[model samples]
Target chain A: MKFRMNPVYKKELKISVRTVRMAMIILGYNAVLALIGLLSFYFTFNYSFNNNIDYSGILQIYLILAVIEFGLVLFVVPAFTASAISGEREKQTLEILLTTKLKPSQIIFGKLLSSISSTLLLVFSSLPILAIVFSIGGIRLFDLIQLMLFCVTTAIFVGSIGIFFSTCFKKTVPSTVFTYGSIILLVIGTLAIIAVSYMIGVRNYDNLYSASSTMIEYNPPGVGHAINLLLINPAVSLLALLSKQFGSPSYLSSLLSHYGKTNTVIFDHWYAISILIQMLLAVVLLCISVRTLDPLKNKK
Target chain B: MLEIQGLYKHYGKFTALNGLNLELKKGELFGFVGPNGAGKTTTMKIVSGLLNADAGDVFVDGINIRKDKKKLKEKIGYMPDFFGVYDNLKVVEYMEFYASIYGIEGKPAKKLIYELLELVNLSECAGNYVDGLSRGMKQRLCLARCLIHDPELLILDEPASGLDPRARFEMKEILRNLNHKGKTIIISSHILPELSQMCSTIGIIQKGTMVLKGTVEEIMQQMNVSNPLLIQVVEGQDKVISLLKRNPFVENIAIKGSNYSIGFKGNKVEEANLLHSLIENDIRISSFFRQEGTLESLFIQITKEEEGEKIEV
Candidate 1:
C-alpha cells in the first residue's frame, strides 16, 4: 500500500517548521531543563561532598530531571493540542477544510499527530540535558528508553484530551480551560474520590469494631476497588515508574497499600497497566473527537 | 450536472430552506441571489457537503449526496462566503495543501497549483505569504485553491462581496473564463447586475424558497409584464390615449404632455399588435416600448411582494 501524509498534518508541519516560534520553544524548553538539571546536580554534589559521600547522589539528579520532564509534558501537551480544532474554526478555515475530500477522522488524527509531533520535538530536544545522568552510573540506556516511551504515552493521552475538548468547543480559550480542567480532575479528582472512599471505609470499620461484642480480630479498613480508579491518573503512573527505576518498587506499592490490598500482579505491573489504561482512554477520546468533528453527524 | 430537490433546512424556529428546489446543466454559470437570511449560504453549504439539509436530496452527476458524500465531494469545489488564510503559508503552499487533500501531490500537484494560480491571475504572487495579500487577493487565492482538484462543479458564495470595482471585474472575468472552460459554477452575490451579466441562468431565493429562476431576458420579461408601456406621440396624443383605454391588455393609462405611460399586461406579441394598431390608426408615434426592467427592480419587487404577503397574513 502507498503511504500518503495527511494534508492537514503536512500543512501544519510546514507552517510550524517555518515559524521562529518552534525554534524559541525548543531553546526555551532545553534551557529550562538544563537549568533544573544543573541546579539538582549542584545541590546533590554539595550535600554529598560535605558529608564525604559517594557520587550516588547523581541518581537523584536523574530522578529530579525525569520528574520535571514529566511535569512539563503534563503542563505543555494540552496547550499545543487544545486549540488544534478550535483554532481552525476561529480562523474560519474549518468549513473550507470540511468541503474538501478529507474525512473527519483523518483531520482529527492529523491534528493530533501534528500536536504530538511538536511535543515529541520538545521531548527529544531536551535529551542531552536528560542524558546528563548517563555520565554517572545509575540510569541505564534501557531505563532512558522506557522513560521516553512513558513520556510519549502520556503525551498521546493528554493530547487526546486536549483534542476532545477542542472539538467540543468553538473557541480556543474555553477548550484550553476545559482541557486543563479535565486534567486536573483526572490528577486530583481521582485521588480525592479515593481519599473520601478510604475515610468512609475507615469510619464504617470503626463503627463495626465499636459495636462488636467481646473481642474481635482487628482489620484495618481499605478503599477496596476504589483504589483502581487511580489507574487513569498519569501522575500516579509516573510515581510508579519512578519508584521502580529508583530500585524501590515497594514505595509505590506501600503507598497504594495504605488505601487497599490490591492484586500483587497489579502493583507489580502498575506502570504497564496504567499506561495501557491511559492509552485506551486516549483512543476512546480520539474516537469521540472524530465523531464530534464530523459536520453532518448531528443532522436528523 | 447538479440537482437539488425538496431541500429543507431550519435553525430552531427559523427555517433557512423550505423545500427549495434547483437544477443546473453541464457548463452552466448559475447565479444565486438572495437577501440576508434567505438561505443562499445554507443551500450552498449543503450542496458543498459542509452542511446537511434537514430533509432533501442533492445529487451531483447522478450520485446522491447523502448516500455517497465522498463522491459528491470529489465532484464539487466549494469556496465559502467568509474564509480565512493560514498565517505563514505562501499562496502556492496553500494551494498545494488543498490539492493534496484531493490526493493530488508531487509533480502533478505543483503543476495544478501553478495552472490555477495563473487562472486566477495570481501567478506572480505565488511565493508571497497568504495573510500578507489583500482581501481580493486572498479571495482569488481561495478560488484558486478550490479549483486545484479540477472539480466539475464550483460552489462560490459571495466571491465578490467585499471587492472593489476593479477587483470585482477581475473576479467576474476569472469566473467567466472558468465557465467558458466547461466548469459548472454556482456563484451567489449581492451584485445583481453583475450576476445578470455573467450568469447564464439566475435563481433568486427568498424566505427559504426559490421565488424566481430563469435567464436574464426571461426574468426581465416575466417581471416586465406588470411594467408600464411608454408611448410618445408626435401628433394625436388624445387619440393614442383613447385607443390605449379601449385595449384589454392596458389596465390604466396616464398622460404627461405627449407621452403616455400605460399599465400594460401583455406579452411581446400583444404589445407589438397594440403598437401596430396605433400606427394603423394614423396616430403618428415617435416611440413605443415597454419600460426596460432591471434585475434589481425585479428582485426588489419579488421580495417586497413576499414581505407584503407575510404582513397581510
Candidate 2:
C-alpha cells in the first residue's frame, strides 16, 4: 500500500501554517537567537583581541546558543502540544473526529508529530544563527547534527508529556500548567533527589567515622543507584554532550564524582543513554494518551 | 442496514439505555423520537462506534461493531447535535480533512468535496472560512463532511435543533433527497412534525427501551385510536349519546353544546360501523370524524405512561 500522511497531522499543519501566529513565532524565535548570537560573538572577539588571548574562546558562543535553543525547546514544545487534544474538546470537534475511521493512536501520534514539527521548524530556522559558530571552525558538522538530533528528541519527549496531559484534562490551561510542572520535576526534581541521597550517604559516613577510635581506610559514601535517575533528565544529557564537545570529558565525570563513583559504561554513554531513556518514556506517554483518547475504552 | 439488540448503557446509577432493541432496513429514513434524557443519542453514539454498549450487539450492514470497529466506522457517518469548526480552515479544506480521515485524497477528494458542497448548497461558500459561516451553513457543512466517505448508514442527532424555518426547511429537503438516494439514515429531533413528514419509520424510545417502533403511518394510526371522535348532531342528541354509551369501544364522552367528543378506541372499520349504527338510529349528524392526533401527542402519551403519570389525552 502507498504511504499516506496522517489526516490529523496534515489538517493541523495546514491550519497552523495559515495563521499569522506561526510566522510571528518563527520571526520572534530567530530574532532572539540572532541577537544573542551576534552579541556573544562581538563580545568574545572583542575581549580576545583586546587581551591578546586565544581566539578559540569563540567556541563558547556555540555552547551558549545551543543551551539557549535547548531551553527554548523545553519551554515552547509543551505550549505547542498541551492544547492539541483539549482544544478539540473545547471546540466540540473531538466527538466528530472520534466517529471517523481514524484510530486513537493515529490521532495522538499525529498531534505529537505536528507539535514536534512546529518545534523543529523553530529549531531549523535558527540554524543560520547557530552556523555562525561554524565559521570559526570550532564546531564540526557532526556536532551540529548531534545537537539537532538532541533537540528533536527532547521536543518529542516534552511534546509527549504535553499531549498526555492534554488527553487527561478537558481544558488547555490545566494541561499546559501540568506539562510544565512535569518538566520541572524531570529537570530539577532529579537533581534534588541526587542531592538528598548524597547528603544522607555523607551523613552516614560521618557518623561511622566519628564513632571510630582510630583512623580507618576512607571509603566515602556515594549516591549509588540514585545517579541512574538522571538518565530521564534532558538537561543532564545536554550537559554531558556539551561537556564532551567542549574538550573536557572529565568535567561531567568530576561533576558525577561528587555524588558517586562514575566508572560505569552507562556514564560513559550518558548522552545516548539519556536520549534513549527519554524516547522510551515518550513512547509510553504517547501510548497512554492514545488509550485515554479512545472513547470506547470507557465502557463498563 | 442497522440492527441493535438488548443494548444497555449506564452512567453510574442512571441507565442511559436499557435493553433497547431497534432495527432499520436499507434506505430507511428512521426517525428516532424520545423525550429529554431518553436513549436516542446514546443509541446513535453506540451505532456510530463512538460508545460501547455494556451489553448486547449492534450490527451495521451485517457487520458486528465489536468484531470490526474500523469496518463499522467506514460504514457509518455520524453528525452530532452540537459541533464546532476549525477557525482557519476553509469549508473545502474542512471537508477535505474529513475526507482524508477516510483515506480519500488528492483529485478524488477534491471532486467529492465539490460535489458534496453542491449537495449541501454550500458550493459558493467552499472557499469561505468554516468559522465565518452561519450556524445553518456550518451544520450543512458538517452534514457534507459526514457524506464525504459515502457511508451507507448516516446517524444524525438533532440535525435541525436550532435552525430558523428556512434553514430547517432546507435541511429537511436535503435529508429527503439523501433518503431518496437509498441511504439508510437514523435521525433524532424534537421537531415531530418534520420527522413525521420526512421519516418512513419512527421509533419512540422511553427510559432505556423502545416503547414503540413502526412506520410513521402505523404509529399515527396507533395514536389515532385514542383520539376523540367528534359527533355534531342537529337533532336527537339524547339518542346519539345513548347509542355511543352502548358501544364497547367508547371509553368516555364529553358534551359541549351540540358537539359531542367521544374517546373511541377503534380501528377505521369499527369506527365506520359505529357511525353507520348512529345514522340508522335516526340521528341527525352534521359532522362525524375522528380528531387527528399528532406525533407530538403520541410521544407525550408514551412518555407519560412510562412515567406512570395520568395523561389528559
Task: Say which candidate scores most in DockQ.
Answer: 2
Query: On a 0 to 100 scale, what is the lDDT of residue B263 in model 1?
Result: 93
Please, what are the lDDT tens digits per residue for candidate 2 over residues B56-158?
Answer: 9999999999888889888999999985678679999998899888888999999999999999999999999887998899899989988988989999999
Q: After superposition, how far is residue B21 of candidate 1 from its true place, in Å?
A: 1.8
- What fraction of the native alpha-carbon contacts across the interface, defined at 8 angstroms, is recovered by model 1? 0.83
Query: lDDT by residue for model 1 over B228-312, one digit each (tens)?
Result: 9999999776678678888999899888988889999988899999989998999999998889888899778878764523210
lDDT of 1 at B179: 96
Q: Summing lDDT over every window of 10 consecutive residues in candidate 1 chain A, give the lowest-scoring window.
A: A47-56
Candidate 2: the clashing residue pairs are none
Docking class of 2: medium
Task: Report per-candidate DockQ.
Answer: 0.73, 0.77
DockQ of 2: 0.77
What alpha-carbon RMSD in Å does predicted model 1 have with respect to the real structure? 2.6
Q: Distance from true position, residue A167, model 2, in Å? A: 1.6
Best candidate, lDDT: 2
